[model samples]
Target chain A: MIGRFLAGLKEDKRIWGQRVAGQGVVVPPVGYSETDGSAGGDWVEVKPTGVVTAVARVHRPIPHLHPCAEPFAFVLVKLDGADTALAHVVRDHLEQLRIGSRVEAVWAPDAERHGSIRDIACFRVIS
Target chain B: MSTSGPPKEPVKYVEKQLHLPYCYVAGDYKVRYLAALKDKTILGSKCSRTGKVFVPPIVASPESFAPCDELIPVADRGVVTTFCIVNIPVIGRSIELPYVAASVALDGADISIYALIQECAPADVRMGMRVEAVWKPDGERQGSHEDIIHFRPTGEPDAPLASFMHRL
Candidate 1:
């Protein structure tokens, strides 16, 4: 049930998280979320699009190889409908980075996806 | 310490394999270091207060607790302050067996860099051995430590032990 919104990521779909109230479907629902274990928020349909809140151009190495292996952008994006932000890598649009730049998720290839946070390969600028 | 309860039923469990690969933002200071790596240069940060340098520069000094913004270009040459020789094989390691992971304190820099040491026998690697970064061709370079594939012995005499004594 918690993955319903994120599983949508596999199909390039997005959803707003929602919590139960007298009469409301919060754009970014306020409650406990099971997706990330710490969300402490409820899940709901949200817009796939978002705006970059914070960004970083990454170029470093660890013991293991990473997908965004070379220099790239690691960013935190606030969704159009949700209040909280999701952290993901951003690539192919280093020149246009600015606060509130529009962006969207790029899903992993079918073979590489296993329906977790990594279902999205990285976030990409909307141009 | 065995539990005093009756044996519980073994619940069936499925094998789970998660392959979530991701990136790490080395941040502003390390990014500066990476940019220099592509040009076959090494960089470290110098504290405005204590004058201590940090390899793979950071936001602040360890001792003085002041913001460190000075970008100092460290030399490609340095001594192997310490090292390890891996003899057993690992399934997914890139380098061959019997390689060295060394701590190198570049000339002119106060801090040392932890990187791979190659092109020499495992037994030959030792503390105070002079070595240099072996860079990839200019065209093949990416802003990464990998640009310098590994360090190799410079064939020069080892430096005096006092130079790198604090590193260990």
Candidate 2:
């Protein structure tokens, strides 16, 4: 029920960075210079297109015990403008995927409501 | 015709105030620091090039950025460089209210470290009072910051102003 209400992003968007109070910078700024501390950093828009970096088939139920009757796959996607990769579920069968299968962002209908990483439905294998 | 009684629904409530214990794995440098703390001894690393000593033993010098592996033992007695009084209480803090947290520069160490001072009243604490580490008993030693317990006034005569001027 959690994922049902809180599903994927409708559009590709940028997530801003903020500094933790009283802590110095540990990670290097990705899109901006160190001197521009006041401005924080600039934003670089990127498309949702990315190749599946890795995939895993999960047969066991999650800790929350939501019934996932059939086998599901988890895919790690390296989006543009981000240093790290985003991990989410994929709906395709295990046999359908190659090492570098192309995947695109799929959004749920807006009428269903709300925002978050869940707004984008699971990545489907692109034909 | 309904013959069965009303069905019961499952109830749920949130439990508050969960406490979790955490253990930290100290590296070689940190290990030495903690070991010294058990004896109420303060140790620091000296920068070979700048000859500056950093309390809590930094792996590298801030100024030269050179690797400092030599462990230097500093005298327990030192002067307070700067400090603040903690009027408000924080979770997991052992000390009570009106405690002084000061940056103490142990003798022979160039840089100061933040530590708590005990065995004195808040009004008696000063900017340049000499303080020394108070160690826990040998049996209670645990090789961590808790080993030192807290710092207290040394009650010794203060060194001349010229002695610590250039070092600062």
Candidate 3:
């Protein structure tokens, strides 16, 4: 589930500091739930740098079932400025997966994006 | 039906395929069940209270709602409880046309598992027809239901309807 970052709402406004601090509850990276504007202000886009808060490896080769046909980990990443963890796949460096390992997103090309979470191909471990 | 002079297409149209990957964790019972498939052994979960056995081990007994952890090895041979012939081809279908997708109830099993009944004519697939698992090469086994490539006829007599009637 891609977060609908409301930070674009008047980026030049004076409340940028307060809006940047807005936190949203991402029930589970895949479940969609935008900031209700009650707990915090409109949730805005934050840097993708974060840590893998939870992880699990998939071992099935179901073609259309899940993305990773080869063995890969499904990690929950807690972005630096975000309040909740977002779920995404981590491949290549499976050994780097842990509760607090730093990571970043590797986005898909512009021609491949259909405005969905697939835009972000997969997460890569940095630390 | 459109009563208008002519049908017109919508102004905006777009096609998209949902290609998100999902990693699912098969729970305790499913883990052990699939693990047994690696060795080509069929395991059943027996409900201590009612004594009913399920081929795909259940977390708990359905009849008496008891904790069913005891794993019992069952026969690989069984009878087809029901089946549908694949006359039409579909995308992503690995199997060829005129195949039988039959639900086979293994011996001493209360529930049946769905699988393809092949190596014979689809027209020959009858309800209660005896069948057995055609496991993949031991080297290719990957701890999944796919380990059993497909089921084929055993050339045995069809089981009586009274035997699998309760299952259907």
Candidate 4:
């Protein structure tokens, strides 16, 4: 399921989720429902837009460790159509980031994408 | 079952390389110890109150809770207090499998330091086995643990258990 999800990001610039028996939809599908242990049953596409549910600010970025050198916030984003939130980073507008803040995914350039989680370079605060 | 979508290739593996680089400030005691290693000399910090010694020297002694004020020179040859034969291969390390890693209590030290025992079969390594440091050639010395390639048996009779067992 994750392979197909990553392939969708690489090939179509899309995000994929899975619909489990009990869970509504899980982004970056794990092939099963984490809550009820039921196998995921359907391929679902979630929107790139999301809401910031959690945020942690990094002030002093360690060299080669943090994704960015400038101050940024690591956030949990609940993308539209996904029941659970995905942990990701917000590189800009960190001061405006808060619970319920609107955000959208920023894709890496086509030439730089390699079918990995990092294919979505980062998220930007929209509101 | 739900309707299947277009066939997609399964990803068996995802190769990702993560690099984490950082600097560590080796304080006064450790800096001096590594410097001595380059000269084929081993220095252990001696606790000012209890006279206990620790290699890879620390400022404070764990036993006496007192400052270790003196860096005493110790012989590289020592007795193995205990050891284990490593059978599994480790990534990045070039050492062959089934080698013995032991804690060697260098003469005149209260604690044991870890060292690899080589130049002999794994079965031949034993507690109390006598071993000596095999230093890399002078120019190749880097003042790190790697300066001493590995410890090898000295053919001397194993130290009596009663003499070194307490240091384990």
Candidate 5:
């Protein structure tokens, strides 16, 4: 399931989720429903845009450890069609990032993309 | 309608590296212990009631359950009470394979310290072996355990097993 999901990001610049028996849809599918332990049913493409459900602002960044050197916020974003949220980092406009804030993923350039979570460079506050 | 065949090729592996950087504050006793290392000195705290000494000095002795307030300097040479010949290489260490890792009871210290034994073939490393520390260049010392690269044979006879048997 993870392999298929990574292929989507690397080859198609797309985000995919899976539908489980009890859950509507989960981004970055883990092959099973976390709520009821049921196997995921089908691959579902989710929108790149999402709303910030949670935020953690980091002021003192540890060198070579944190994603960005300057201040940033780690956030949980619920994509348009995904019932669960994806944890990612937001590097810009951290002051504007809060619950219900609109955001969108910023994909890595085609030449620089690899099959990894980092393929999505980061998320940005939309409005 | 029947489902289409599976996708032609699937990703087999996705490589990732995790890096976490952090700082640690060594407590008072450890800070003093590490500071002494730069001068090629080994320090241990002694229990007043039992006179037992422990390296990497602790606040209290487990044996006597008393506070160890006296810091004592122990000899650089000691007896290997127990040891293992390591054949597997560790990821971050550059030591050659088939080296000896041992518990050495430094003179005056009741507790044995974990150290690497080198400068001799693995087959020659044995229980009760007498060894001495091989220190790094004075200028290169960083007040860490690495100040003593490893313990090597001291050309002395093996200590009697009876002398350090309790430490095994």
Candidate 6:
């Protein structure tokens, strides 16, 4: 049901001119141009390795049920070459997460077509 | 967690129009008076020479200011100058049904007031139709647009469209 909701909001067409840093490559991602009148930006791809800049514990469960058990950690990950950090739920326990913890993006088996930040699964600890 | 009882009945719902209170402030003098409407009572300023009255009065007369202080009581009942049908539903409206909103020119006032048209059908409404204020009961007046319930057609003969043509 959640997947369907996300899929309904997804735009299949790519919006040119806006660039997003993905997997360490600065690629032309789906977004509008802030300067150029035309669509499409210089696309580049990057590695997915990132550092955990901040981490917070979630004591309460979200409205929807997750496949995992209760008491997970959420982390703000600063991917390389990206201006802003992406927020993703951390599956590790509260005691395990710390500043500077290296993590990597774990893609869903079938990339969830949700038009949301959760298209990618939780970032797992690299070590 | 699974519930032991049988499934509960789903709630039935429908969308309704929400009427929001709006102050129709027009003209320079009325703008100043409307600013004070929230606090004090202010009538239009009248020209002493022309004997013409301006509600929420203007500083200078459109023709010439005679420096008049003569303020007259304007009957709330006025004729509709112009109006449009609001068939599209707006989000967060307080009035439940689709209603006609109009610009009414109250008696003894030089200016027209924009307000909601009520108690009439969209087809029944026409320009220059006579309308009156459906005021809230005594002690319920808030001195705002909401104070007057939506104006209902007075069933009086429609005024000549030419009389209000210039104002439109």
Top candidate by DockQ: 5
Error of 5 at B39 (Å): 4.4
| lDDT, model 3, position A28 | 28
Q: Given candidate 5, what's the lDDT at residue A116?
A: 79
lDDT of each: 0.72, 0.63, 0.71, 0.87, 0.87, 0.59
**TM-score for each model:** 0.52, 0.54, 0.53, 0.62, 0.74, 0.46
* True contacts recovered per prediction: 0.00, 0.00, 0.02, 0.23, 0.28, 0.00
Q: After superposition, how far is residue B31 of candidate 5 from its true place, in Å?
A: 3.0
| lDDT by residue (tens digit), candidate 2, B1-168 | 121211122112222344556887788788888888777677889887888888889999978999878888998778877678989988987678989999888888987777799999978887778899887888898877777777899887765656666544
Better of 4 and 5 by DockQ: 5
Select the stronger candidate by TM-score from 3 and 6.
3
lDDT of 6 by residue, B1-168 (tens): 111211122112222445566876476545445544333333556677876666546666767745655554556677888888887788888775667888887766667778898887877888888898787776665555566667898888888988766545
Instruction: Report the alpha-carbon TM-score of model 6 versus the true structure.
Output: 0.46
Off by over 4 Å in 1: A1-127, B1-9, B17-23
Off by over 4 Å in 4: A1-127, B1-17
- Please report how far candidate 4 places residue B159 from its true position, in Å: 1.6
Instruction: Choose 1 or 5, whichever is better by lDDT.
Output: 5
Residue pair clashes in candidate 2: A7-A118, A7-A119, A8-A118, A8-A119, A8-A120, A9-A119, A9-A120
Model 2's TM-score against the true structure: 0.54
Q: Per-residue lDDT tens digits of candidate 4, residues A11-116?
A: 7788888888777888878889888898888887788999989999999887777888999889999999889899999998788889999999999999977878
lDDT by residue (tens digit), candidate 3, A1-127: 1122211111211001113123443422222334443333333345667888898887775677677679888889887665677778887788767889999877666566443455567889999
lDDT of 2 by residue, A1-127 (tens): 1121122122222222222222222111222334443432322333466677888878764643322446677888655433445677676656776558877666656763244455566677774
Candidate 3's TM-score:
0.53
TM-score comparison, 4 vs 6, better candidate: 4
Identify the CAPRI category of the predicted complex in candidate 1.
Answer: incorrect
Error of 1 at A82 (Å): 35
List model 1 lDDT by residue over A1-127, tens digit each: 3344444444433444554443233433334443443433344455667899999787773334445666778788877765667777787868887778999877778876554567677877985
State model 5's lDDT. Answer: 0.87
